[model samples]
Target: MDSEFENQCLEQEENEEYEETESSSVQEKNNDGETTKQLSPREVNTIFNSETEVCEYYRQYGLQNGSGIMIRNTRKIDGVNTYLTVACHRYGEPNQKVVDSLKPKPVVKTNCKARVCAKRMDEDNKWHVTQFDNKHDHDLSPSKAHRFRCNRKLTKHAKRSLNLYDEAGIPMNKSYNALVVEHGGHKNMPFSKKDCENYMREIRKLRLAKGDAVALQNYFNKAQSIDSHFYYSIDLDDENRIKNLFWADARCRATYKEFGDVVAFDTTYLTNKYDMPFAPFVGVNHHGQSILLGCGLVSNEDTITFVWLFRTWLTCMFGNPPNAIITDQDRAMQNAIEQVFPKARHRWCLWHIMKKIPEKLKGYKEYDSIKFQLQNVVYDSIDIDTFEIGWSSMISKFNLENNDWLNGLYEGRHRWIPCFVKDCFWAGMSTTQRSESMNAFFDGYVNAKTSLREFVEKYDNALKDKVEKEVNADTRSLSTTIPCVTPHAMEKQFQENYTNDKFKEFQKEIVNVKYCECMMLQSDEAIFNYQVEEIQYVGDSQTLRTVKYNVVFIKDMELEYEVKCECRLFEFRGIICRHIIKVLLFKQNVFTISSKYILKRWRKNVKRCHSRTKVTYSTWKDTEEKRMYEMVCDAFYRIVDLAAENLERCNHLVGTFKKLELEWDTNDKGCSTSIVTKPEYFVKILMVNVA
Candidate 1:
């Protein structure tokens, strides 16, 4: 019996040693592994089938450990979520509005090794956590995890407000603060700042300016829906990425008809994330305000891209090419303009032409004087022969014969010199270029990191402000008191016929009338020529430079007169020159100058002068009465178009309307003392009586 008991003890000792060795080896193999057994009966009954259900299971599982875990990666087969990897993250927690991408992800070096991957089985329509590595190197914190993990997901209302502010150009930080205040603070908020950032990125993507291709498609669709007259054309390369894009709004198209005669094209500034040069076709309005005619985005200012853009602009403006176009001295622009607008006088931007003078010539002696001389040669040169003589003499005097830059500039003189292109109408933009002002104007609208979507939106706002300014100027010109003018019929005619701003300009010339004198140089049956000279003396201080002008005039139908001047001020500035005004006064027409001499652009009736007035109403909210007033004005516009005929016909209609106005006033005056009724009743009764 004693021998059998000792043998049993030895057998039990051997079994214990074998069991301990097997357990240690099993643990050593599972550094990051979880249970390999089938789930318990309770867990098996709680198995998930769909992606939503499986995701819910992971959420619950994560919560049980006092930490929130999110889906770190997801995969699908045949467009169904068939697999997913989840992990616990510390920073992924949101005060509110956390994005899935911003959810904290686990790293290999971290103690939190919590992870679960689920896959759908083909044999059974069931989902299983095929791989779950639930081992951790650190302790889990529930309270801290609760701060990130949502007790409840974001509601639909909150999401709507989020998207609303996102589109309104509100910053994420401000939005988050507002949301935190509304949601009862960070501890109780549903998402974190990281979550909001992710949402913003998604918003950017939706605008189609982000990295997503699908989002770009959505942007075009939405833009068109908002502005039906909004037109956009895109050219893409083999990679299916945009190479060129052009767009124009209804207001731009309408403004172009009158102001598009001379356009300044500039594309030097980069105001987008894609580093694309933003090109704006800009023009000056009758109000002397800079107006946007159209805009484009191009990967490069190459000939090919420029060709597409110019063609697109023509298409937008109904193929009516501009009479004169100005742009910086970019070779690509030169090539494109020659092809697209073969007839349009292509002039190099004057600002860029002069900008290089300081950089290239400032190092020379008498830099300031040299710059002054150069500008005079460019701007003040009156005749081609005079410009040539001054240019040759200045070059020789400055010893710029060896300067390659001057040589290059001389070669391109026709493009930048005013005298060379004096015949071309530049619309008061001779001394101005598109670069300095364009860069300044766009700097307020966009920055280097602006996205494509943001740029498009900001452009409309900028354009809106410009148009509003123009409208206000027009209103002020028409409604405000007119400035007093000299009693001369010529000056008085100008004061009533021209806008207030233009009157100020004419006033300058009229004031200088006394500072000048004219004499008849020659006369003929067909024409009369005169020499006009300006003289100024300051009490023996210094005699100012004597300026002279040669003006020719002819009479047509007894009273009809025509004139041209050597100064070419009217040719370039789009206004009658002081020389021409001097000739008219010298010719003794003192009654009134021909209506043909008055430019319609400078006239107070420019808008009224044009018959068509189709208004593209803005989308801002307005009161009912204001909306009704706009609609009534719109109806009046239709009536004007219908009655668009000779001036006599329009005057006849106006006379008949005045008779009706008199009858209505007579009735209103008779009723003012007889009626004591509700305001609406009186309004209705008066209309009924008048009708």
Candidate 2:
């Protein structure tokens, strides 16, 4: 009657005469022929209705007495066990053969002579404990009794809770600690943390017995049935094992049509137990938030895998490749991008290249000066000629012509140097920071120990969070506005049109206009050249310096004007710079921004098709009922497609569905009445209508 089994009932007794004799005590003599003591009923003679009950009672008694119990022997008559003996776990000698094995283990058996013998009574068809011994040869550990394997168990409710925690990506240790705290302490808990972990491991093994590939396929199939826009592609090896996987939901595909011009791809994060690389294609949304366009898991980082992933993602997004792509300087990735996205302007991440300077040049005596000059040459160059001149000067000055790392970087300068790649629009990004940020966003949801099956579910949870954040930003943009800091109509125009986050970026340039001074240097019939001197703060010391940029203003036939600046800020970042604003607004008296400059991607009121596609994070168990539900949904989806072709058909289908729902509800409530019908009749009606 321990607390663990308070709700358990004993097996039914066949004879009523022996039921009242469930407990009895006996006296035993000591070795010296003196009466030792009177034993308790459990330690002397106890009657149980079943063999299992007898063994459980003896095990519980051993636990209370600070001893581990194990089944010693059993004698069966034909098929039924007629005699059984339960003994102390340390009641026997270790086998000499096993003790002398090559890989030896410490022996815990001490030949303790404590045991209980049970026999079946033919008259009552019940088991009775005929002999028992409560004495032990070794010291007992009452306080540590719960640590014995025979005493550890997890209840049904605890198992259910642990399964839920496992699905939510909670670590086993944390989940175990939560249970310990809930049960008051570790001693009060029924099982050890290791026991909980073993249970979880067994569950995972059962889930993966069919292989991770099948689990992934079933998950994708169910997801697509729930929402037809969910997309997934799996590449298999010759043995039909999963080699690579790519997935994108409806929201991701819809969002791509708007912000897929520039993408940042990276594969530095690993989230599954298989150690496969997690590659995420990330982009910047209208609110300057990092959005996931699509993602994949690859078994290898070679060119072939990259090609497969890229092509699969391209197909998912309706074959619309990004105009510009940014990634680290991986030669394999570079080759893959060239083969798959030939038209995409591939740029190396400048931050990634710049960060390697210390590691590559730290051995040099003048490493600080070399790094400083290299940064200046990479960042401060105004055009290609200036970059080449500064690069050559730095190499010659540092006597680094023979250095391999520097030479290799110089050969790839056009892919990373700002002055060389400024002509192409990169959405204000010079590195793969967006992809890295997206990876960091999932840190709280997944970890290195996550299984492939668990990772798929956690991925949905993380994406749902991202969607909710975007929706909240949209709501804020619609409900609130940021005030313009300048009197010029251009700042006000941006404030009215752009989202609040983008509007804040525009206001930054307007604020920096005070640091710029523009003066016309030359003039023609329809063209004017101006020199703009801008003050910039440099380094940690905030040293003040002035730099001059050339701005050209050209007037067209219809009085429309075009402005270009040597800085190329607008060309590279899609944002007009402070120097351009000074010349166009302060010098030329221009009032409003041009229509072409207002990117629809950043407009506040532009409706996105992806916003209507809901993202759900609910998980489904792999059961027969779930599979059947998916089949039913798939059939209904086909019917919906046919009905949606015309308004008349759609209305007719909706009316029929309503009538069916009403009849089902009515029938469900009339089950208690005399009038009852099988639900298959409704299915017959539905089948007739479909035919």
Candidate 3:
């Protein structure tokens, strides 16, 4: 009977089943050469006598047997083939051959509950299927049935590299490309870019789950705890969430109080993950470098938020407002400044205002020509009358007289136009360029996707780098002498007095002084003054235009010279214009620049607290915290250096400190009130050093 089944399996492989052997009763033939009506019940029993025979019958009936069936168990009853359990495969194998990674992997799951159990009768010594079920309740899509992940494909090294790249703020696509290159190509790579993308996203999500705002709060709290001068505050919304924040360390506050005469408040930089706008109050140092005074984060640009942010900054600085403040032209910002800094000269950022002109007039017929005319109107105007006349002519020429935007700009020209605010102290900054540079300087440290904790940490790191750069500049300025490129005595004096960067600027104007020649156009005997004039080549008209100015020599205790120029170069910026230099050098026979003309703010020795910023303690507090911190740092390094030079100095210093401790601890109250005590572990360290 087995041989007959084998022959049938080979001959009818395609058809599965064509005939049944004579082990059962032969039934009468029916239509289409089929037989069934004449079969007795005993014939059915004989055909299913063995479980193996039943399996063969199912195979012939074309059942899905590839990994879909399972042999659950088997049992022999009284030394005879008794019973067996069968079930459909729970693990699908759609991509089994491809996912054979030689590492442990999860199998695809399925709800295939098709089961069969066969029993053997003791009398017949044969197995019969007692219970069977082949129908499955769930539908199986061939491709998507197996969707489990294979993490073993990423080796230990790959995972470490992935995390390292993530911490370094490398974007996901770049990290995946790196992995691909390391493995030769994408085809040879064990994992796909999707895996890297998913992994990095999961890590960032976990980091953010720690609460970005909470992280920032904790950092500021810990910092202020260590040093009370590290001022930080957070304004919470009605819902008790962080809405606005302001922070300034001891160094930042000191730098501000010194250079706070002219400041630029930048509120346009928005690159953080939470979309919080950065507001850095920046100032120009003596070296012509941008210095950060303090930073703020706001949830929005509305007047309410800006008001809160500025008030918080004032509170941090002990109510010290800057002399001249500049920012982008925003209505809310303007209102906020009016409310908080009523005494300050609030000016709009020239660059920000100029940047919008192109977009606003983009629909015009001749935009380039109009933009050129606008630049002349905004930048090159000599005085208020000149600026107003030039602006009127440009708008009328361009038929922009009816344009509301142009009219609005003309109305608010005093806030940005240098001619209108020339007498105001700006420290040579016409716009908020210092604040823009400040933003660009911090771009290297923080990114748009950085978390709050990372932002705080990176901000500190960036501040450290900035301070280090300034230190290097200070060292260079002190040790290296500025070389004179011209034979002018005034040039030599400036080189000796000003910083390298400031001297370079002075040289630019000095070299151009040769093209400009001034002559006494008129004389005033009463003031010992002369109306000197110079003719400059006008580029637009291709003509020599004569410009006039007056210079007076007076003795106010000592001999001093004063100048009034329509150029307003010295009035707008602190530096003397080339037109003034022409008269001072050629006609006046003044070799060295007048003492009254050279402002002390641009001196090379700006760090010296003599003529520059005075060392003042915070009026809000009694303690000299910044000075104390500096002294501690200086003393620590000196001690370390001295100890390295002489090992006995360590012991001597420790002994001296211990004696001081005795005096502090032995109070009338008999309590140790000192912040320090005799070291309990220093003896062991001393012994180690001795050995």
Instruction: Kindly give the number of clashing pairs for every candidate.
Output: 14, 0, 1
* Top-TM-score structure, candidate number: 2
Q: Worst lDDT window (10 residues) for model 3? A: 143-152
* Candidate 1 local distance difference test against the native: 0.70
**Superior candidate under TM-score, 2 versus 3:** 2
By the lDDT metric, which is better: model 2 or model 3?
A: 2
Candidate 3 colliding pairs: 68-89
Best by lDDT: 2
For 244-336, candidate 3 gives per-residue lDDT tens digits of 778888777877766778888887776577788777888877777777788887889999998988888888877999888888889998999
Q: Model 1 residue 306 lDDT?
A: 93
Per-prediction TM-score: 0.64, 0.79, 0.63
Per residue, candidate 1 scores C-alpha lDDT tens digits across 1-691 of 9999999987876553332111211222222475432111122333466666666655654443455666777888889877776666532333443357567554423435566667777788787776666554455543344455443455554665676565455667888899999978787676777777777677666656544234445566566676677677877778777777778877788888888899989886674778788999988777566778889988887998899999999999999999999888899999999999999998887777777877899799788777877777776677888889888988898888998988888899998888787777776664464466667666565777777776776666666666667778888888985666567787888888877877777778877877778999999886899988977553356857677778898876686777888877777776777777877776646457777767887787766421243333334223454555445445555545645665755665566557656755776766453322223443343334333
Task: Estimate, for each residue in 1-691, the C-alpha lDDT of model 2 and write its tens digit.
Answer: 4754643422222221122212255354644699744324374456888888877877766664567789999999899899999998888986566645688877768888888899998999988888887667776664566788889999865787797787666778899888988888877888988889899888877766688888789878888887788899999999989899999988899889989999999887664779788888988888888888989999999999999999999999999999999988899999999999999999988777877887899999999999999888887898899889999999999999999988998899888888889999888774736545766799878878778777777787788788889889999999998987777889989988888988888789889989999899999989999999999999999999998899999989998889999999888878888888898887888888788788887898998887877765454455664455455556677777777778877787778788877766786765442222333444455555654
With candidate 2 superimposed using the best TM-score fit, by how many Å does residue 352's alpha carbon deviate from the native? Answer: 2.0
